[model samples]
Target chain A: MSASGKIVIALDGMGGDNAPAMVVAGADIARQRYPDATFLLFGDEARLRPMVDKTRWLKTACEIVAAADVVTNDDKPSAALRKRRSSSMGMAIDAVAEGKADCVVSAGNTGALLATATVGLRMLPGVRRPALCSFLPTVRGETAMLDLGANMQCDANNLVEFAVMGSVFAKSVLGIDAPTVGLLNVGAEEGKGNETLRDAAAMLRVEDSPVAFHGFVEGNDIGAGVVDVVVTDGFTGNVALKTIEGTAKLYTGFVRQAFKTSTLAKVGYVLASSAWKKLGQRADPRRYNGGVFLGLNGVCVKSHGGTDALGFANALGVAVDLVKYHFSDKVVEELNRLRQALGEVPAAAAGGVAGAG
Target chain B: MSASGKIVIALDGMGGDNAPAMVVAGADIARQRYPDATFLLFGDEARLRPMVDKTRWLKTACEIVAAADVVTNDDKPSAALRKRRSSSMGMAIDAVAEGKADCVVSAGNTGALLATATVGLRMLPGVRRPALCSFLPTVRGETAMLDLGANMQCDANNLVEFAVMGSVFAKSVLGIDAPTVGLLNVGAEEGKGNETLRDAAAMLRVEDSPVAFHGFVEGNDIGAGVVDVVVTDGFTGNVALKTIEGTAKLYTGFVRQAFKTSTLAKVGYVLASSAWKKLGQRADPRRYNGGVFLGLNGVCVKSHGGTDALGFANALGVAVDLVKYHFSDKVVEELNRLRQALGEVPAAAAGGVAGAG
Candidate 1:
């Protein structure tokens, strides 16, 4: 495949439990799947050669960009960003910032990536802080849930910006025109939710929202899919995400144990293997691997570092799609419009002031 | 079941999915299951008679208290409390308030029940607002997650009160001694959570905390059983509860589809029936039906209104247990001690605050 007219994504190869092998395998899969997309793998070249030799696609379609070391899960976010200058994640982000790659993908450390990306790419013109946004598969449909874990704390203005950015991301990537944005609160009533969301709801109600702002949504309503964007402060959003993941795991574990309890059940399991695999595939970690860090100057996709080859492949696909869709530009434009609407004052203004927004 | 030695629990026979039938059946089950318990069924004598006639044990162990009216699920909370003066739920609570029954158990409209109990029984001294607290099963153990769908908005003081009340309830009812009270934040760091939690954390860090106070806990930590009492403002707490419930439903649904996929799986399904049933029983909504409204002067157990006989029975058991364990007096005393330690200033010193409990 020719490099011309192709989007280049810098993939942090030395991240995740599967690490170099999964990254290499995923890169090969992406190269075979999307001939128009090229991957630049950032990791130690010596460790990657074995997998590179095994795949024909990797030889021509993908390229290896050598980095000295890798970031470990044990490292603190600040220390890793500061001390690990030659780490794969740091180099991958640098590649995007230096104009060598259109976007960056990493499964390494979410906090480290957020910190480094914030320092490396810098926030956009009107963006105060970036939010980690992901598409949650809800009963109503798929919707964008913003600040899934990025900022631990946020004022009402921060949430307002999150709504705007989430709206644009959904419109551009999810292809939802005039997406309905909802503030994740305790209830759908305007009188519901915390003080931060209550004040933010007032802003969302009257202001010229970038998206179709649809009042407030409760946690159960998240799956009901009343809106395309669910805006929340990082703390609540993070808890919501983890709770969903944990509950899913626990329920599935119980079912698996149930199925293996009897000999007759073992026979049923054999016959049902294919259908079970299909269902598992539908709920696979790979299918929803990439979550974008919005409100930055450039695109940055963070995949779960604990994923396998399929997950890494999905992350790369997300990076390529994000670059093609120009995700960052859309988010930046929305942020600018929102800032212009709210004036030059800090977005954190109305958090303590209640209805100031 | 002799009346003198048995614990007496009043049940709202007109509440829940099947109304008098489920209530009557549940009361019978509880009576037979625990010989030392008696039930007072409060509902229309005509409607409850046929259901009560179905069981022999209920005839002798349960007494029907005549109530002329019913509180419909769709009625407005305030209107239900005002207009339905002789409703089953109202009568059951009244029995407790008048010291005729040790506890009140109702599978009635949650909002209406909460409002009625608050107005009729009144808040305990130093209890600014009451919270609906329940236990959500997690991987490590059950988490004491509270204010689940209670007050939509809560301030720092309200959170502090919830922590104290939840701790006391857990200790007295759940038999968890010196429960580690944790303020649920986005992160475990002291300064991590939102402003309300941050302020609450500061107050919780004081030497005079009513329970064994841990600094902070995250969403995943809830399932990890790192803390005995997980405290948060109502908005986040409600969202977290619903999110876990929704995820559990989604996962279990997927697993059921997995089992019924093919012919051989049919055999496995039959063999696994026992294990599946056991697992199902563990995750059954009926088993976890009741939620206690803490901070009130009397024991009020609210079960899901749309519940089966098994669920209603669980609710009755919860009420009986709370009464036997003296949940109300213990929690109220803890709240008073906490308030005194914090140097409970008059309402004037506390200034303007919404949901100040």
Candidate 2:
């Protein structure tokens, strides 16, 4: 925030399928909600200037910073961070790290974005690794799932950290005061999973634990809206998340095919277009575009790489909401509560805010 | 099969939600498909005789065997196998081991049924563990996935065994020649997944491998019909399977809600009733009831415990198909080919067919 009460955002240009144009246009849409917000955009000056010039309020609100390098999808995360500090994604994150902006938004390669942000803005104290949390509309309402591929393999301790992170996310972003958290397992029974899951369950079962633990839940529970926060290792979480998206696609394809079978069916589809339109909104991937990177020192939102401008705008909205919620501080408080419940306090001198310079 | 050309089947009459009535009624329906089949029904004769008498041909087709005990849902699988040998499930599997029946069908406890059948009927020569394979309808056609909750943690070799078993399943049951088998992973790239998956892929990539290896596939690939057979460890496979089921249900619920929003939609729904009926058939879970136990000495099918006679009959149908296809023998052939592809043949003296006495 500035002296005049403006929210400053750092934009990663030259990221995603449609880069500078989508980034600039999305910023324009987002500023309508946060009129006092300004953008410190990073990308090629030549490529970004025209896109910025076309927007009404954007031209006055944006400042474009030129960066020659770019992060490709194939580059390994750690390698990308060590090598591409001058890249657009890196510079955008640097603005946040420097406290030049309150948050950063990028539709870049997910691994690169995660790596760069983790290295530049860094992690909050007492957090081992950051988790990627996203939402999907369930039967009851929207449910949040965490570690959506940030850490492929997580142990018992790592899982507990993720649970705390997810709890804070459910509270801050999803607006749930006391969100129920469930450990993803193969079966609902207590004795169903491996040692790590059992150990994690034991930890979460504590009476004063940070989260309201709902015990173990199976794969079906994710869509059944069984819990507000579904926690698991990144590998399983990623698989389940993608599986849900694929299934939604498959079911939509089936419905479309069913409606195309005959003229009467087609007429019925048109006559009931309003109802189907409501469904279209329900299943729209664009509505859930932002994946919040939890436990970071600053707000960093990862937009879906292939999403359109509207999706990009939604990502900006997410970053703004996260900024309003002070997500990182909430995470630290939750972690403290969790540590207290576990009968110990986090180590001293590491500091509760940023652990690194 | 006997000299009279009848396919002998063993039925666990005291299994599943509906018990003896569902079991007997299902047998009658299955007999209509395979008119040359007879059942050795295992349960109390007092209860089975009345149901057999209700159907015209069931009385002539079924011979009720008095098994005094029954296996309950909560019993641990191995413990149940040891203690309940005279139970209906045990007696039914016993018929197959004794070669008095060609195969068995049980809608009992999945773990108990898998345990009893594996122990009683035994594994084919060179098989370490048996996998449970099931089918789901896809965009291209039906795709088979194995280790659907059988082996929770699979080694590289275990996964390879599953691949060969799944390949055989695709050929014998799904009727695909030289089926393209895919190993499930977090990403499609060769570098993705853990060591077990990478090692399994290396083995499957052998030029003379039994299955046509499609490399790595993501969770979405299962519903996308990207390959003929999808092979994964039981834990991940179970979660993905249930997730798919959950997603379909969620989508169906959303569609129903959409259609109910307006009177015009209700009218259109009635007018396009036939199309919706076809869609209903496509989505019917009973249409895909049976989960086949692969690499077992003889065929065994696990019907969903909650299913009605129709679903039970579908499972019976699956067993008959496996019998006609000579599934176990085909699995042996596939395993032999895989062994050849792997360079060193399996050690001798295990016998070529059934491993147990």
Candidate 3:
């Protein structure tokens, strides 16, 4: 009966490669599946009406909140957010800040979305910077890799914050308590890699670590699932992310080609067609589409530029789940608690434990 | 007409992951395949005697250059080469330097192999750094990617030298005349990535580049076969190489799990078994095993650490082919000619190329 029982997710309609269409399609699916969910689509009134008309159920199920403009992926974040206050990304984040929505979602410029959420929704107490978190399917299980591309230049403090935020996100969202945090480096040995990673590893290994700090893990171990949370600077994280994406595409292409090269192979292909399709779907980036930029005050998701409708739907689904679980507030409260526990901050009233906006 | 019609490559009996056994196996295969080919196995008299005994026909067919000790993978290159002067790696390189063997083959420590070859056989004139080159199989075909993990930190000059040596190796050995060289960066744009890559990209675009410089390429394009040669520093290259290996392993594993999930899947699995196996073999690192450290005075090939007989054999095969074409000399001459043509060096005769060593 209350809004708390039904997640209110504000979708940035003018974001992503297929923008309003994908956003409307995803909303349509979500509304059809979950009656309790309410989506407030933010964008230009004229463009969205045509898109929502196709969805056929937005009149009663979802609302289109008119916004002045949209943020282009190529524009600088600070400049775009400053120039266009009513931009979809900014409006969606504002909705969360104003208590009109529990979470904000954007497939727009990742940097702009992150900046808007950080500035608009306001970070949880004691959380210096928000980090992006996503799952990397490793041999053991899915491990959360953080700061996927949030801060380009991270110091020891930044990494510590990332570890705390990532750990909290993994625990609250993925249902994993005390997730093992690892410092991603060129090697597993303690002192291997660039200065930043080495310093971060040392900071993470402290007895008072906010999370379960594991020793260093190598690039290969990311897929092997050696640790639950892998933390690194955005530069390396971006490269690692793209590298994995490229490799997956390459392997899938090679496998398809290999199967098509022979006459007998064609017969085998028909037999294994369903199985192969499932394998292809499993490897599909759409299933794990949106990469959340955590540490910010609000929930923001960045989808791949090449994402299809399924990917858009997955992004929306993640947003809905995150809002319903009150993911942002949980992360902030966990970090503040850890900070106070570690004597980094004075004991605050109510212990800063609060629900998501 | 003998099977040894081409240049004779000597194998170090005490080198590689499966030394003696793998070394002997590869040599036997090479000898049987190439009627004119001969292998000079070198190692400890006691340990190698049994391995030699097993291949008695290979004994008369291939020569044994006796050495007393072995070089461990973890040993420091300079210290190992200095203290163990009669070690298998040192002696193997000496054979080439002395003209008793055209090239030395070893799957031992890459650092040790590189050091021995650089110190013992000497580097070509004007070559500041040697690159480890490997064939990266792309969708179009196999392209050469160099500096896989030889020089860890490289300057602009070192990258230029790497480009020239890599171009020559790919052209002379792989038969790609005037190979198109691409500088590997985070993005394809000229000004993308960090300072090192941007500077290297500029250096590569100059008129003095010995090969056909095709500007920049991303990690994805490395195996897309868009360029004949992809050049980068050892650190990034190593990461890229391992990422590809890890992804392939992960994808294949996923496929296996998918097939084993159900009886219907099992039926499909059996039907597609041959196609899957063919795909695995084609993507196998063994078939494209061995990385050649170009710019060394003599050819030094570094096989994978996990290599078996087949992979080792591929390394030996590469070494023999390199020697037959006098790969090192061509690189040396090209460097000298480029230096003179670019007015970076005084006019020198063809014989003066040896002085660069």
Candidate 4:
């Protein structure tokens, strides 16, 4: 928690499709919900200053920091890293690195944001790589899934590290005390997936494991909410995440088309509009727009670039929540705890060690 | 196509959750739809004959082929192969290989089914490996995706073979002519996935390609119906398929919960019951039960292990349709065409060649 009783959130005002307008409006919306939060807005001052000035809430709560260059969505991570000193996205992440802000929120290019954050804040000790973690809508409210697209190829150790980080994330952000974690595989069976997954599962099943290791979970288990945190290599995680998003959109489209097929259907749709509205609210992707970069030294939240003001606001809320809960510190502590527990076993016998303890 | 007007479908009477009861009931249902379709039921004749005889439709449409042993769902592919002479699932596939049946349908162990069919029927020339292909519900209609869980690892050539097979399967069963195929990847960009995927995409882009290659598509495109055939390695394909199924179930669960939340919502649901029913029918997992084994010399469809009679019936329909359309022959022709088109260039320069021609 901040000593001043107000959390500082660094905002990349020149990122995303709508850029300044969405950033300004989203900050205002977030400000209303988080009265104890302040913003360090980074972008082209000429464009962002007017937008902030027009917004009554942002005018009072945000301070604009001039950044000449903006990282475009098409910019590769390597290219974005080279422009870190002048890009708005880079400056926003730097605010977190410099401890000027509690967390950074950017509806920017995902690859660029990840690259900037990794180089700016650096990875936490004992963390091999940072994973992109987010809350996905599941049957049991929402479940935290990680490594959405950070490291495409992951070793068993990377997956084990992800399990610890994802567990800490679920607890800190989703407020689950001892979140159950499951390694995403082709089947729930012990030997279902490739060697990497099997090895990761073995590590997670240790007695003193940080997460409540739930053997192995299949893809269907993701939406079933079989576990609080679902861990996977970035390649599989990204595919599953996008597939869920796409499937939801497909179903929604089907419902819309079905309603318009006939007059009776249209009338029925009108009658059930209120109920459907509630369902839509509950399943809205905007409410879960933020993807937190877990295992980083500082809190970094990535909002979807194509999101609207509401989505961006929700992402900002995620950053605020994470900072308030000290997510990064907790993750570091958990990882250290996991390493200590695993280190006790003899190095040569590590592969044969079964339990987390 | 089958020489006779009647398409013979070999039924694995001992497979799936419901087993003999569901198999008999499913055959009766399928018979009602396809009067020309006959079944060769493989299982314990003592148990299956009694069940089949009790049903008027099954009694006339199905013949019992005695097989004492059943392939348990957990049986390894190697173990299943050892029991090829005795297991019901094996016998069912053998019928197809022996040309006693036009096609075979089983709701048995996927790995076992794939292994048995591949060994029994052999892969069509030019196909490096057989792919597990199935219809997935998409916004436009159902799209055929291959390598659902057959080959966990695949090379670029294997992916190209899958693309050809998937395109042929789509045309034969889904009745889509000139079906557009897309290589499944992390991103749609030319530089987006692993080297193998990039290489496959390069091959698919050739000017005279047998299938209509639509370049790369992300996970979301699977449900968006961006292409008629989505091709990928088994690992990614299986994960994506199950993710879609899981997400759909999650949403269905949400709707059920929402409608029960309040009395007014209950009333709204009653009024929209008809529309909701239609939506349910369209999105029913049972309606899309069968997964076709492509690239094999024979037709084999794997149904959901947990599916009921209606679902099993749908699986039977898939096998019948595939046999009627001579799916395997079409796939062989398409692969040959693809190979010939690529063969125009020097053998050493084949991989670097781009465009269908």
Candidate 5:
């Protein structure tokens, strides 16, 4: 937030596939949604100025900050940090850290964005690590999942913290009251899964813990909306999320193929097009575009690099919502409460929490 | 195969949801497909005799073995092993171990089945553990994946063994020529995943490696059919497989809901019913029912406990195919070749390796 209490968003104009244009256009859409919000467009001014000037209200809404370098998709995170600190993605994160902007939204290389954001903004006071979290649509409603590729492997404390972060996230974003949290495991039984899971489950099961622990949930439980929050180590969570996306595409292709099989089927598809459109709208990947970096000092969102203007705008909306809800403050409070409860159980301390798996 | 060159299969009659009836009926169907394959049905003779008698050809094709006990689904693997040795599920596994049957198919408790099978048939030479494998429908064709919940965590050597085991299974079962292998990891890059993945990849990339290692593959690649075999630690493989199943169900539900919206949709759904039927047939869970326990000394397949008669029969087919192709002997050959290649790399030694993740 700025001195005048207006929400200021830093945009990485050169980040995504259709850069500058997509960034500028997405900002234009977001401007209408949050009229009080201001923007800082960081990229090459020569290219960004024209793109901003062409928008109806973007010229008055945002200012183009000059940045000469970029972090390409193929660039390693370590290399990007060393060589491209002056890149659009880096500058946007810098703006958030320096309080020049309220939060940062970048559609750049995920590893680079994660590294840059964590380094620049720093972790929250008690957070050992920040996890990538996002809400995925389920049959009943949206469910928030965390540690989505931020840490490939995690410990008991890490998972317990994610549950706290994700529970707060679900409550704030999904508007669910006392959201249920489940540990993603191979089975739903109490004795099932690795030592990390068992330890995490023990911690969560304690009375007065921050989250409403729902015990263990399997992969099928994810789509069934079995819990409001699904927490796991990054590698498994990332794989599950990508597998869901790929399976959706595969099944959708099958549906399309089935419709094209015969003349009668084609006619039926045309007559039932509205329902298909509704289904598409309900399950649109674009609507769930942002990957929110939780446990950071400030709001940081990573949009899908290949997303279009609409998707980018949706990512911006996620940042706006987090900022509006004072998500970070709530997370700190929840973490404190969780830690206090965990303190009663000495085994949950970070030093004793390395996973046997 | 028996001394007379006839295939022998042992069936656990009281294992699945439909139990003795489904097992007997499925055997009747299998008898038609393989006239020479004799079944040894292990269960209560009172229940099994009637089911076989009711079937047209099952009475002649199968011999009922009286086993009073049965392993319940709720029994733990360790408990089942201790107390249920005389149980039908146990007797079925025993027959294979004693060479009275060439293979066994059980739709009983999964954990119990895996534990009992491993103890009874034992692991093949050079195999540290047995892996659960199953082929899933992909965009191009089917992709074989392992070890689906056999080992919760895996090291470099465990994964290398799975690659060899999965490669041989794909060639023999899916009939894919010289099946390409992929280590299921968080990313496709060489430096992406944890130490376990890196070590496994290094072993696979060697000059004289037995399997065709196509670098690393992500979760999306499983459905994209990027490789014929995907090898991973049991936890991730199980989660990915179940996620694929969940996503397929979620999308299929969406397709069905779209056709239930209005009068026009209802008419369209009925007219396009054939397409839906065809689509259902293409993605039928029954057709992909069996979960093959690879690296075991004998052919052992686990059918879905909830599956019907047709599904159980499909599992029988998998066991029959493996027996006919001398799967166990071929696995030994492949494992020897893989071990020889890995033997040259001193770092690939099991005692020296453990995953940092």
Candidate 6:
């Protein structure tokens, strides 16, 4: 938090498909919502300054930090890490680590952002692996899921860590005091999945665990909002997330095709357009653009690269909310409490686990 | 094949939620469509005879085989197998294995059916494990996906086998001459996913492979209809399949809620009722009710346990289609060709690989 009780957000202005234009436009939108907040914009001075100047609100609220290099989405994580000192994405993350900014928001290459943030901010004291957490729409409400694509292959311990992190995220962001957590598996039965999920379920089911463990949940349960937090290995999580997105698009396409089939349907579509628009707004992907990288020492959110100004603004809003809620600190405190209750040493004291690629 | 160029299908009369009644009704519907086909109904004669007598078509075309025991949905696969000789589910499968029926359609416990069928019918030559294959509606059309739940953990060889089997299925059932096969993965990039998927892609991309390999496809591709067949390990496949189903239901629920929000929307829904009905029929779960158990010596289709008569009839239709097309023999032929092209010895000569469970 800054002196005026406002949070400072570091923005990677040169990231995402729209680059400085969307970033500046998004900051302008966010500025209206959070009048007290300021931004440290990192990008090429020549391109970013003009964009910032065009937006009166952004010009007043943002300070441009020049960086000569831009990390393209095609850059590998290792390549991005090698250029951390000079890249806009890297410098933005660095500002968060140095405590100059409360959090960092970037519409950049996901792999690059995760790599740069992990190395720049480092993992929290008791956290083994950081998970990429995001909220997905469900029948009940938005549910938070973790390890979306962070650790493709995870052990029982890693899943346990994710469950804890996801629970904290749901609590702090979704405002669920004691978020219910369900391990994603093939079936709801105890003996359904592989050894790793079974073992993780056992650990989560313990009385003193931080999460309100709801045991195993199948894939359908995710969309049904069976629990507040859904935990799984990154491979399965990533696949499931993408599958939902794909299915949504597929059905929407079907609706469009149906409307075009006849003159009566075309007229009916017009008559029903208002209702359909409301449904579309509720299912908008832009509203759920931000994916927070949990378990890091500082707050870091990755926005969708292809998103527009509205989506980027929503991403900024997420950063603001997390900072205001003291999300990172709360997570650390929860992990420490959990460790003590389980009679286990801090991850740092136990020799910190290797970071996942 | 049965006498007079007809196909024989064995029905488990004691299976499904509304057994005997639904089964008899479903058989009557299927009999009307496939007038030349005959059915061998297995269940307690006392319970099945009356139901069979009530349905005019079923009474004329079906022969009832008495089996006193029933495999409850909660019954373990092992327990179901123990009662193989006495259980209706087992006897129906046995009918296929013993050459009395061309295929078996069951609406019983999935685990029990998979277990009993694998034991009763034995594995097809060169197949390491049986895959639970089914069709899912995609934007372009319907696509066949395999290893939905069987073979939870699969190797490269097993995935290749699934691809071959899925291709044969699409050709025989969906009527695609050169059905393109895509490996279901986390990304379209070659290097994405675990070692098994990578290895499977390598094998699938070989010049002489039976199916037309379309390289890698992401979760979204399943719904996009990017290929005729999608192959993946059972765990991911099952998760993806269920996720799609859950999402479809979620969106439909949203649409329903939206239509009820205002008077205008209600009128619009009424006007658009025809289009909505068409979309509903296209997206009907009943139309895609059956999941065929592939890689076994005999053909067996599993229907949804909770499905009504219409749904059960569709499952029976899937069995009849497969039998009429000689689906089992084609799969075996494709696998044998695939093995020879890869310079691998026949599975039968090498002693067929053990079943997954």
lDDT of 5 by residue, A55-150 (tens): 876679898889989889988899778755689999999999998998999999999999888899999877888999998988787889988899
On the 0 to 100 scale, the lDDT of residue B313 in model 5 is 86
- lDDT at position A277, candidate 5: 84
Better of 3 and 4 by TM-score: 4
Candidate 4 displacement at residue B160 in angstroms: 1.1
lDDT of 3 by residue, A1-357 (tens): 145588777888888888878778877776776677788889988988877877755546678889987789788777766845688878888888888876777778876777777788667666777777787666676778877666656887788788887887677556787899888765676646667677766666655556798877777777777788888766557666666777777777877777777766677667666777777777767777768877666666666656666677777666666666677677776666666655667655425444422
TM-score of chain B only, all predictions? 0.89, 0.94, 0.90, 0.93, 0.94, 0.95
What 10-residue stretch in candidate 3 chain B is worst by lDDT?
A: B1-10
Candidate 1 residue-wise lDDT, A190-210, digit = tens: 666568888877777656546
Question: What is the per-residue lDDT of model 6 for residues A1-357, given as tens digits with 9 covering 90 to 100?
Answer: 965788899999899999889998998999988998899999999988878888968788899999888999999999999999899999999999898999999999999999999999999877889889999999999999988998889999888888888887887788888999999988998999899999988877776666799999988999999999999988889989989999999888887787677777777777777889889989999999889999999999999999999999999988888888888777776666566556675445433454532
In model 6, state the lDDT of residue A39.
Answer: 95
Tell me the chain A TM-score of model 5. 0.94
> Each prediction's Cα RMSD?
7.1, 3.8, 4.6, 4.5, 5.8, 4.9
Tens-place lDDT per residue, model 4, A17-36, is 99889989999999999999
Segments in model 3 whose C-alpha atoms lie over 4 Å from true places: A1-6, A32-36, A53-58, A73-82, A97-100, A111-132, A147-157, A324-357, B1-8, B34-37, B74-82, B97-100, B111-123, B333-357
Candidate 2: tens digits of C-alpha lDDT, residues A1-357: 656667899999888888878888888988876898889999999989998999987888999999888887767887678656688999999999999999999999998999889989889887988999998889999889988999888899889988988887887778999999999998988899899999999999986787899999888988899999999988888889988988888888888888888999988888888889989998889999989898789999999998888899899988887787777887787787777777776434225434544
Against the correct fold, how does model 1 do in TM-score? Answer: 0.83
Ordered by lDDT, highest first, the candidates read 6, 5, 2, 4, 1, 3
Best by lDDT: 6
Error of 4 at B215 (Å): 1.1
What local lDDT score does residue A293 receive in model 4, on the 0 to 100 scale? Answer: 92
User: Which numbered prediction scores highest in DockQ against the true structure?
Assistant: 2
Which residue pairs in candidate 6 have backbone atoms (N, alpha carbon, C) closer than 3 angstroms, thus clashing? none
Model 1, B89-155: lDDT tens per residue?
8988888788878888888888889999888788877778889988866666566878887786688
* Native A-B contact fraction in model 5: 0.66
DockQ of each: 0.40, 0.73, 0.39, 0.60, 0.63, 0.67
* Selected candidate, larger DockQ, 2 vs 3: 2
